[model samples]
Target: MNNLNYGIIGNCQSAALISEKGSIDWCCLPIFDSASVFAKLLDDKKGGSLSFKLTDDYRISQEYLWQTNILSTTYDNGVDAFQVIDFMPRYQQKDGSYYTPPDIIRFIRLLKGKPQFSIQYDPRLEYGSSKVFTTIEEEYIYSQTKDGKYDSLFLYSDLNYEDIVNQKTITLTSNAYLLVSYHEKLSQQSIDRCYLKFQRTKTYWMDWSEKTTSYPIYQNEIIRSALTLKVLSYEKSGAVLAAATTSLPETIGEVRNWDYRFCWIRDASMVIKVIADLGHPLSARKFLQFVIDTIPDKDEKIQIMYGINGERDLTESFLDHLDGYKNSKPVRIGNAAYIQKQNDIYGILMEVIYRQFVEFETTLENREELWTIIKGITKIVEEH
Candidate 1:
């Protein structure tokens, strides 16, 4: 029987899929909100992925490390064995601010006997809708797109790809190891700088994971979910997406294709409650602050289903050229809801403010200005 297993490693902004045989099936980078670079999970041929597999038969099993987003998958080929570790570093508190790359890392280690493996690293640009240019440096494989609109990916692996047209194979003896990394577009110097950053990033994640408070049951799963939620949050704007992928059907071949690249007010409020219940009150407060900073006029006439860094303009459009997931039609980007009128925003905003004051012990320092705006909104509501 061929035993196959899978696990997930996420930075809370984005996530990756690691198979038991040491393959990375999916990953999106820079931020959870960014377009996918490796999207083979949606389309095997067109969508790209990073894959590592053995030439011979192997049995596989996978699981996440305790209370962390780190994942481990083991491959046993009768007498031989090996494992792959995958993780995305978490944000760190250094110099009173968080620092870490929005990248994914995978490490493969040999355990017992010799094993031959083939490594395939393919990256598609712009949600698998564009071609990518691949470059091979001394220790890294760089894949970049033309327009420079999306995040580039850097792969660091021992497997050489001098002639990428031809598939390459490598042999690993017991105790041997290989590391692969992904990052955004960077110059040669910038790539060189990442080596040091790799060490720092690993330490940062390990340290942060150490700080998490323990739970009695389902601790690992809960922490992974929490981290996933956290990564989906826009630290600068406090907006959170429902998910990373845009066209993944809630039901295959259905019209459930909705773009999740921007912040949703509904999801943000729900996240506030989730984070608060998880004992991360600061995160909830930050989201509230983001909401307050985002609303400019407070007139209640300027509300939307979603926005980008508080920008009221999100012009929705469709991409007719590229086929949708599972052949689902009409792949669309952006949101046109900003143009619509939602009378409920005024009451929702008032309720949010009230909830913040009561649950978070928040008091608006500019109460006079806030009340003046409230009076205007009340007048509008009364008149309507």
Candidate 2:
């Protein structure tokens, strides 16, 4: 049985699910709403995954690094031991902007003796409907659909490329790194650069966690939940996702499944309220900006949800090629609830806006904008 015993690693731009055994079973690159590059969680056969196959005697365990989104999976067999550290690059740049690319780094470091494993780098582009062809180059391994919407991925690794592609068992003598990216990197690529990125990302997460309000009781739980909420927020648009995945049935072999990758206005506003109370006003401010940007015109009918990038018209559809999670069938993407007229959304949105006005000080112009939005919401509420 396929269980949800997976660790999530994301850069706020996109996220991936790593199994307890160190396999990237589900991931969508570049952004949360993009077509999946790895979807083995949905279909074990046609869906693809990047995994490390170890011997039977090895013991495996998965856990997130303390105070960071970095996930570490360690494998041990008494004589040999190693850890695969997985994370997506997310950090601040020199100009105060962020450097969050659509990339996942897997750092394999040897802990003791010589640990041997095989790499399975299978990527099914376009929901496994497109025919993908993988080619090797000196700097990176490229996988793309031979025919279709021009989807591709680049994998830069310090390990042997041939062995990785051939799935041959190799002994780990020292540290190795694999960088999977949605776009081609312009800068020079090396193991040292990979390690630097890992450190920077670790620092970013730690700093973010430190900024959250901690309680005397359940401090760890609060920080952990805050980190999870932070990861689900879209950095570019400040839209909070209800969930990252789509089409996992509520019950096995049932059709009660829907896509949840989009941002619901009511849901995001409520989350912002909690986050603001936790001393993270930055997220709340960003979400307010998202609300403003989404409803530029006061007459525009607000949707229940919108794309992370503020895209409307989120027409839902199904991918027939891939099997549903656990044979539930009817894998779906996008969402169809945007057309629904949920009157209570304005109330939730107004609550957050009201909190922002009372809790934080802002510029006169910004305050005026909020006041105007408040009037707009009041008018809409009266109309409904």
Candidate 3:
């Protein structure tokens, strides 16, 4: 379950990486780089995990649903088979806005025969230290942890349930759904309504793919990679992260893993070009806007990386409670590179600025002022 081939689902604000076994092992709330609510990817014992695995032993396979980020996991044991549909709530509203609530939706569909599943709803907050307390209701379950970082997380299921802390095995032969939310204790959308949103989510993603994905050769590879990038992007501000999980070491027993939750300017600038080449020019343009908004007129130097909302001071910190990936130790949160001197970013960003002129027909607003800023930055690079 700790391997790298886990499927990922996101809706701009946050992301969740679920293992092929249908366990949500790594997920950060509010945003991608925030403290992980489920950290089983780092430490299996103390790390938080929510399980939805089949009772019967079977072979499992997972893939995206027809050019979408929505994942479909199938389990088959010759006679009996079932599938788990996983996706975040995201679809275009009729008012030209998006209805992307902070919720994770899972639909269990009986494909061939009856399937039974074991349920484990354990949520450890503040990087797997603060255990979440639960209150089980007639139809829904409410859980609360410490106040500051991720206070309330709830799960509403259509299945008949009584206990929250300790739960027994549940069997399902028909369609069922579970909606887990981070912000609100109760979901604004009902459990049945979540089913409709799942359909619309598939439609919305496929429609986006149909419009944006157009490659003659190596089409599947290109589309899947593009979809991964799309899920990693923060839609509200157009910032893109390097990866989802933090402190995952390259080699076991080696503390080589660094936090990659922040959006680096040099990396994002290149990603914008790649996204544009893949046919989503709008996304590239939005990332450029994010870069422009990060320009600090007052500070003496520009930050190499920032939060999705243009936050600075990315002071790195270690989580002492949980051991590092594979016991590498020193599991870090924020990136310390923000305080270092990164000089090559000017040329990298200038390359993107040149791309803006070539790829986009954007009118150069305040040409003289723009040149003045560029010249200033170039001078700094030369001086260094």
Best by lDDT: 2
Q: Model 2: which residue pairs collide? A: none
Cα lDDT tens digits for candidate 2, 210-236: 888879999998888888888999999
For model 3, give the 10-residue run with minimal summed lDDT.
363-372
Steric clash count of candidate 3? 0
In order of listing, the candidates' clash counts read 3, 0, 0
Question: Candidate 3, residue 185: CA error in Å?
Answer: 6.5
Candidate lDDT (C-alpha), each: 0.63, 0.90, 0.77
Please, what is the TM-score per model? Answer: 0.78, 0.97, 0.92
lDDT of 1 by residue, 1-384 (tens): 022235666655566766555567666666655567776655667777777656557887787655556677787888777776676655566577665456665556678887666667688877776668888767567777876464566765444456332456666663333334445334442323443444555565556555556689987767677766765666666676666555655666676676766666655666667666676766666666666666546565545456546766778777565566667756666767667766666675565555656666555563444455567668878988
Q: lDDT tens string, model 3, 227-255?
A: 88888889888899888878888787787
- Model 3 reaches what TM-score against the true structure? 0.92
Native-vs-model 2 lDDT?
0.90
